[model samples]
Target chain A: MNAAAAYLTSFLRASYRDAVAGWNRFWFAPTDPATLAMIRILAGAMLLYTHLVWTIDLEAFFGPHSWVSPTANATFHEVPKISEIMEQDPYRGRSFVWSLFDVAKTSQQIWAVHIVALVTFALLTVGLWTRVVAVLAWIFAVSYVQRAQGALFGLDQINTMLAMYLMVGPSGACYSLDAWLARRKNPRRGAASPSTSANIAIRLMQLHMCVIYMFAGIGKFVGASWWNGTGLWGGVANLEYQSLDATWLAYWPHLSAFLSHLTVYWEVFYCVLIWPRALRPWMLLIAVPLHLGIAFFMGMITFGLIMLVGNLAFVSPESVRATVSWLFRRTRPAPTTGG
Target chain B: METSSRPKADDRHQACCPWPNELRIVVSLLLALHVSAIYVGPFSMGAMGVTSPLALTLRRTYRPYLEAISTQYQGYQFFNEPGPSHLIRYELEFADGREMVTGKLPDIDEHWPRLRYHRHFMLTETAYTLVSRTAPPTPPPGLEVGTPAYESWRQFRDADAALSRAFLKSYAEHLMSVHGASLVRLYGIERRYPTPEEVVDGIRPGDKRFVSEELLDTFTIDIEVVSP
Candidate 1:
């Protein structure tokens, strides 16, 4: 009896150790920082551009006399049940968050805050003072996002998310003014070694993307239209959202069905298919066109582009470095000295 | 491509990576919490039950808070439900008896300018979402005068409907004022259109050409009139 108990204890200990070790290796393994930095530049540009869209009718959405007056906006935040789901008020700012809305009572103040946000976004894109400004950029993203809660959509939500995760790591590690400054400070040294920070950030993004797509795919089952392939038509047929009306596809029901089914299956199984190195290229091939199609045909250009950017986490760092090098005419950091 | 050699602790330029076992454990825990924070929302909504006793208790306690935060981050259930789509159009009669009509608040120009105005329609859609997407409370059985639950719903309906009306009034005022009208009587309506497939399938009669404008609300702006 005593011998059997001792063997069981040993087996349990070994199993626990093995599990912990595997978890550590899977998540904390060092990875190159290039992909994350590239994502920052692209996503930051997206953030800047999205906020830039707000400028066309600056006060129409936020001013007291505007569409959503301050009183209505406050009701949107304070009212329970309705606001919780509909308004999507951020929990952190129930009482009030620093919106340019509060101080930008006048159109001049509104544009002033808007310009500062744009500058911050530009800096974040180029990776200047990233550690500090990334947080500031997040503040800007959140403030505008919550303030413009009425106008929010998939584009704003995902933009704010990428902004949050970008702040999690050393996102300025490459393809940035900060990266060049680092090399300038230590010119003799080759590019720095891969860090656990980059790996963790990429892992979180990958995981978060999985959650998004999985739920997005699953959510379709709730609707009768998705089952019948009518939901896909709904996007194009709705004249309000239609840009390049391909409702002509009504005659080609077979093609419409194929594309609709492809989207659902691709999204539902993305998290699994994405992990395999061999399937990675194929998944991207399907995803890029799917997103670009939405942008062009469906008229949700920013939302579609942001969705594509979310998939950028799956891209390998080496490819990012090569692309950057190609663009800048060999301006990237010297190839790494260590693996 | 990664280089042949590996980085060392005493490298010429330092790289800070928390590579210790304890730190990795901490990271694992943090990642787990973060992932869980996102997961619980879709799970609870999708009926992916947590069967374990401890898990169920923890979920029951923290699920509401997490649902709010998670939704704020990414409510990616876009187009999961299918229904009639609407566009608001307003017609205004100035005190001088001249009348004006506009597509909606956004009525933005073509190309890039249209993207900016998508927000106006988004606001209207949100009101529709609040009204239609939410499961209306099952009116409670006791109907003497004012049961607490019924009263709560009564208050909600008034607030919710009033909001929709208020938005119509405000935008109507602003848009009409732009047309050189000081005082205007405005009536708002929505054009309800069916999906392409709906028309093709004849879900109802006249689906193909079914374009009906539902009267949303009628109100006065900077002028006294009968309540609508």
Candidate 2:
């Protein structure tokens, strides 16, 4: 048993080292300017959206007593019964833990955290104080996730992983206001670090995304509802909550069951096989349709599209360009790099 | 002559672009895909136009509490319900000392009448059940009754199921008239009630059946209208 445990520990340590080294070589190698530029722009855009979306109110997303600010006091709607965890028999013993949140609920504490998180996310997007802002965003996001584990959706999970990845280096490497200003002040210092910094960040993000997908697929496998094809059925059944028409799905009685079975299989099989080069494209292809179906049938557009973006990591740069060129005839001029 | 010029230009471009042409093509494609995603992708994602009044209104209503809770809690709830709508939703308190409710409410627009009718009807039915269960055997002798007292129910003939049913319906209708047509409707309450026997059967002795037993306790009535 000790030998087995030691083997597992050693294996994990080796994988971590390999991951960091591989990421450095691939993502921040200073060879693929386009890849680097793409990463910067994409990450920036997502961060910008995260901030801009919050220009309204942040409390709407979570309850008054968030993990980030449990002492917050305010009267809002009851926190939703997100999981069977609360309803589970064993969990009854720990019911007091849940009720404690109600007694200490405060909107102020939540608001304070929101202010910092939003500002940090915005700064990170603009690449201002890049590393510091990245760490701050990660900290804030983790705090939020812990407050209501059940309330967490896919987008929050993805962003939390993103915060961790961005910690490795200055994501403000290109196309940032930070980069433009740096160029004017000192042109020689405009380039990204030749060290493995970006690679570390990008690799973590990629691995983090893989874990998310694998976990999601695993969750689906454990669910009888997903296997029965009614996993997506519950949303469509509630007409008041539905943003789109999904009554047709229920009409075909057998289809729901079939879909549930297929969904579970896809999730489980993809989780285990996604890393293989031979199967990666196929897995992504399947996921794209599945995600798209989710967007259309369940009104989960944001999450479905975000997952699609994550799957883009599996796509080779060559294929992505080919696909883009085929769709749009306009060719982008190459950037001029000094000899 | 054109072919000759094309080769020279191609050679010059090849010399300039050390990165594979394929790489440039792929980058452009990826950018286009991303840009397209921001456009006609799915749902109403990229369709938010600044000038659209509907969008603006939605933004105004939605924006007030978007930052109130952490993004960790993204779920729905009623505008004002007894409990939170979902596990993830949080309440927001503005600096001005007012509570802010966020998330979507059940769509009542399509079933407005049904919902309205049911709301007050259920309350009335519940009131009747409580009265039937807890009403004393008799009012105190020589006591003066108020306008809202249950005395009006005394005029009806007893020991007749039909008479009792009619009496209950009439009483409900009278309440509706007084409450205003907008406030009370018959469709809101189910006409059926559990018979005394059904209530008694539900009681398991030794269990907490005292509430049901108290409800089943017999009573006698003697009401008179002395004035007019």
Candidate 3:
């Protein structure tokens, strides 16, 4: 009895130690900011474009008499009163969401706020004072989403998620105007040093992405079509969602079923498989086609592209740096040696 | 494209859990709390009507933080069901005896750049989602009134009715203002997708047979538009 107890205690001790070590290594280890910087440029560009598109009908959608009226918008953001909470109302009240648009009542005010938002997004994209703009970008992104609650989908969610995480790290450490300006000021600075904050931000994004896919996959099980392998057909045959006329997929039922099954399985397992170095690439590769397919075939180009940008969190800084350097080298003219 | 090259000596030294132990512990706790919150959002919104009680509790606890950060609605349930899409069809009547003008919430021709069209598409879809929740489940025959079950259903019905009214009325007033009309009629249209068998049988996806419409509401200019 004494020997068995001792062995059990030893095993538990080793397990706890290993778990703590792994957790610390995963979240706190310093790393290059390259991946975060790349994501900033891409996600910031997406944020800029997304807000720019709002310019076409800014007054109609966000003006005083907008699609979602002020009263209804207020109702959407209402939180449960203290009395209701104390009474244990089963149906929790709406959330207490904040938005800058809440204060911008007039068309002129809305346009002024919007132009500032656009400029902020552009600055974030160019990596100009990214530390400040990244936070503002998130605030603006969330404001737009909260104000126009009815006109949102996955695109806005992913876009805001990327922007939010970008604020947690030094997203403009490299490949940014900030970096160029820094170099011009002091030519002695080496490559951006590894950063613990960068690692934390990337890890958070990677974990958030895993959560998204897990839910997305699990949610499909609720539908009857997803079960009998007819799910892909449902999306493909939907006239409203089709961008490229993929009804041709009707002729290939078997292939359609294969893809539908593959999608669910990939999403469900991504959280697990993505952690292993060997499996991470395969997971990311699968994400490319899956997102691109949605972009081209489903008419949600922005949503699909933003999701791919979120997946870039799984990519290593070294890989991003190497790939970018290779592309630049291929594009630039070769140096001529003195004859 | 991943490389397995060894880190530089300095990078390796710095990578060894560089944060002080106290900071590491603090962040670890926060990280655990955050990840749990993230998991709880969708876990409470479980698939196949299977929400766990634990998930619901966690969701309630984290609701404020999640909302403040605008991460509460990240269900990520993309194409989960892929059911019928929705649109709002409207007709306007002017006071001067002008011919009635008709339009749709998301006329692709008018709403250029697919994103704009998608935004309008989401408007109708959001209306449908909100209105659908207003329908309470039918009570069993001979079920007693004032019981817990009946009270729950009654409360849900009342709450949902108020919510849907606010949403539909706002939309109605917007249409009236846009058309400069005295009266506006709105209809919710649901367009179901064609099945594979239907497609094989030469039926197109956009056939009128698959479309159904219901009158959502009607509004006059006298309906009070709330000031911002």
Interface RMSD of 2: 20.3
- Ten-residue region with minimum lDDT total, candidate 1 chain A: A84-93
Who is ahead in lDDT, 1 or 3?
Answer: 3
True contacts kept of each: 0.41, 0.00, 0.72
Clashing pairs in model 3? none
> What fraction of the reference structure's interface contacts does model 2 contain?
0.00
Two-way DockQ contest, 1 vs 3, winner:
3
Q: Please say which candidate is ahead in lDDT: 1 or 2.
A: 1
Show where candidate 3 strays beyond 4 Å: A79-95, A334-339, B1-15, B48-50, B136-143, B224-228
TM-score of each: 0.81, 0.45, 0.93
- In model 2, where do residues sit more than 4 Å from their true spots? A1-55, A58-116, A146-151, A183-195, A251-259, A316-339, B1-228
How well is each residue in A135-211 modelled by candidate 3, as lDDT tens digits? 99999999999889788999998898899899999999999999999999999989999999999999999999999
What tens digits encode model 2's per-residue C-alpha lDDT throughout B27-93?
A: 4465344323222111111121112443333323332222232321222110101110111111222
Candidate 3 lDDT over residue span B1-228, tens digit each? 647587874566456789887888898898898888888777766664345666556666777777788877777899998889999998888999999999997888898799999999998999888888676456667767888767655665665666677778888778877778888787899999888878888899989999999988887788653331
Per-residue lDDT over A295-315 for candidate 1, one digit per residue giving the tens place of the 0 to 100 score: 887788888888888898999
Error of 2 at A234 (Å): 3.6
Candidate 1's displacement at residue A199, Å, is: 1.9
Better of 1 and 3 by TM-score: 3
